[model samples]
Target chain A: MPTISFDGQEITFEPGQTIIEAAMASDLYIPHLCWHPDFPPHGSCKLCSVKVNGRICSACTFPAAEGQEVVSSSEEVRQLRLRLTQMLFVEGNHFCPSCEKSGQCELQAMGYYLGMTDNHYPHFFPVRDIDASHPHVLLDRDRCIFCELCVRASRADGKNVFELAGRGIHTRLVVDSPSGKLGDSNLDVNDRAAHICPVGAIVVKETAFRIPIGQRKYDRRTIAEVSVAEEAPLLRKRYEQKED
Target chain B: MSKKKIRIATTSLAGCFGCHMSFMDIDERLLDLAEIADFDRSPLSDIKHCEQCDIGIVEGGVCNAENVEVLREFRNHCKILVAIGACAINGGIPALRNRCDLGDCLEEAFLTGIGVTDPKVPGDPELPLLLDKVHPVHEVVKIDYSLPGCPPSADTIWAALTALIEGNAPQLPYELIHYD
Candidate 1:
């Protein structure tokens, strides 16, 4: 197994492993949206852009070859991410206070992680529609970042329920049915796509705030702390070091 | 001769006054702050008019003609105008009404609303005219800085204040900058 040096630590990985996957395995977080372990990387959300050998690339798709130097924690990267977060913030009506996914949203957590103190850019506040036609799932296009997690999730599981439509800045998520609504699609409350949305765009109806604010997953521990998949080994190493 | 104490003014326009309460959550730190800063025009002091100040904190979204006038006055008097909390930053929960027509909202609330005994929308001249839409502070006037929590945490407000006081760039840890 060849190793790549990320930030400064060497992370060993098998061939074809992306920087993001290896880093996650070693409990190193690279701020990202539109990425999940269960599917291929879409790279739609550029929040995971990192400097690999001084070239910017998506960590979730960038392969970790032998001796690859990746910088994920530089001030420059933070600034870029902050601006990107601002773009997302003003591009749509992500009025966080009124949103159901305020506490648990990955996009909101990413903004905090990057220290986006304010939305510096003038807001677009584009008008969007919310589709509550689904019996169980709610589709609030205003909150959607077009991550396509739902689209990819549906494809992976053969549901074919969600897809991306339009182009450029007009790009948006669409349902694969005769009517352009979730209710016409095959998605259900139990669908994996329904649960994979990183934002509040797709949510279970009548379940808003079921889990109290401060008790939500990202609230208890930061998205970075919770994102570390290899916490056990990292913790055990620290524990053994304490005994020494 | 003594150093001039920093003057701070805050106002809530169309919000729930949660930001002001959260500001108070600084607790005993207010004692330390008292040595360096004084309230010029704030709900805490019940001041009626904003005077010349070092910092102006505008809470809540601007939703009426009077709110616009007060916000402009704050801008004219204060050296730095900071929009605190979500309402001040991006209209917060109040901006939800931006989706519907103002006439429809008024009609729903005062005319055809449930449990209403009389359906008369108040038409008094004393009432301030409503703006066409609820607007974040920056949309109405220049905001030097903004803190974008639903009600920015006490520590977040403290960090911004002390950073301005100490004359440094305000930086916050990951946990402090929440949108909710």
Candidate 2:
């Protein structure tokens, strides 16, 4: 067992756990989007960036070490997270009012948690395609944040149906099929990839606005509260199961 | 001695006036607000032009040349400009047009749309020129504060306004701050 100081609070972690995993096990949220318990660390979204011993590092990828001091809730880290959230908003067409994933979306919840009052940047307003070809699911590339949760999930499922192509600002999610469409790919409705999107990019069909505006997840509680109460328990259980 | 009332002005540019309706949703609280503030130019007052005011609350995106002109003029007249609602903050639904070509949008609306008898784009001199894209108010002018929501709840608007009137920064709680 190793101990690390997270935001001035001493927390314990196993030898191989990342900062995020260690934080979750202790019920301390680091405000992450790409680091889910079921998947390996992708480290794409930098919302989980924390200052480890005065050096900035992605908590999802940074290993928790003994005697290390990690600052997650400091003003500097909070401002950085806010700016990253704003950048994510402007980089895509995140029209939350019109988006189906408005309430349940991790990005939207992160924006709320960061107290984002405005976009604070000019919107890129890039043209993105929407693939409604899939009978059970819809692919709206406008909302993708390149977190690659779906990419990992599909690969873990042995589907390899989703992949990232292009580079820099031109990078986009592409299907494995020749037609470059979700319907033409081997992605099934029941696949983990279909339900793993942190944003509204890939959503099940006929499930839009299933929950009312004020009643949805992240509507009543803040992301930090929800993450600790709902997600931390599951993550802790998984860790305990692994140990047994 | 009586306190000097704060002057507030508001306007809508390219929105559905839903935000304005939300403001009116303040309901009986409007009477409480009237004691501390006076309306200079607003939909409630029916004033066409803005006057020098302590706060200028604008709700809408900049879609046409007239919107830009109005926003600039409004920005110049107020000490603090608050962009209220999703339209004023992020262009809202009108920004969906940003993905499409302006020419294509006009042609589809007037010329190629269903049941179009006389198909021609209007070029009247009186009409304001449409901008290439719908932009949030901050893109056109500097906004002092932005309250995000489709139409921010009456309580949220009340909280921000009262705080602004008292010369304090708006500290919206987690429940009050929502994009939708």
Which model scores highest in TM-score?
A: 2
lDDT by residue for model 2 (A1-244), tens: 7799999999999998999999998989898888888888989899999999999999999999999999999999999999999999999999998899989999999999999989999999999899999999999999999999999999999999998999989999999988999899989999999999989999999999989877999999888998899878878888889979
The Cα RMSD across the true interface for model 1 is 1.8
The deviation in Å at residue A231 for candidate 1 is 11
- The fraction of correct interface contacts reproduced by each prediction comes to 0.62, 0.82
The collision pairs in model 1 are none
Report the lDDT tens digits of candidate 2 across residue range B1-180.
Answer: 999999999999989899999999999999999999999888889988888999999999999999999899899999999999999998999999999999999999989999987999999999999999999999989999999998999999999999999899999999999898
How much does candidate 2 score in TM-score?
Answer: 0.98
Query: How good is model 1 by TM-score?
Result: 0.87
Candidate 2 steric clashes: 0
Give all candidate RMSDs, comma-separated: 5.1, 1.1
DockQ of 2: 0.87
Which model scores highest in lDDT? 2
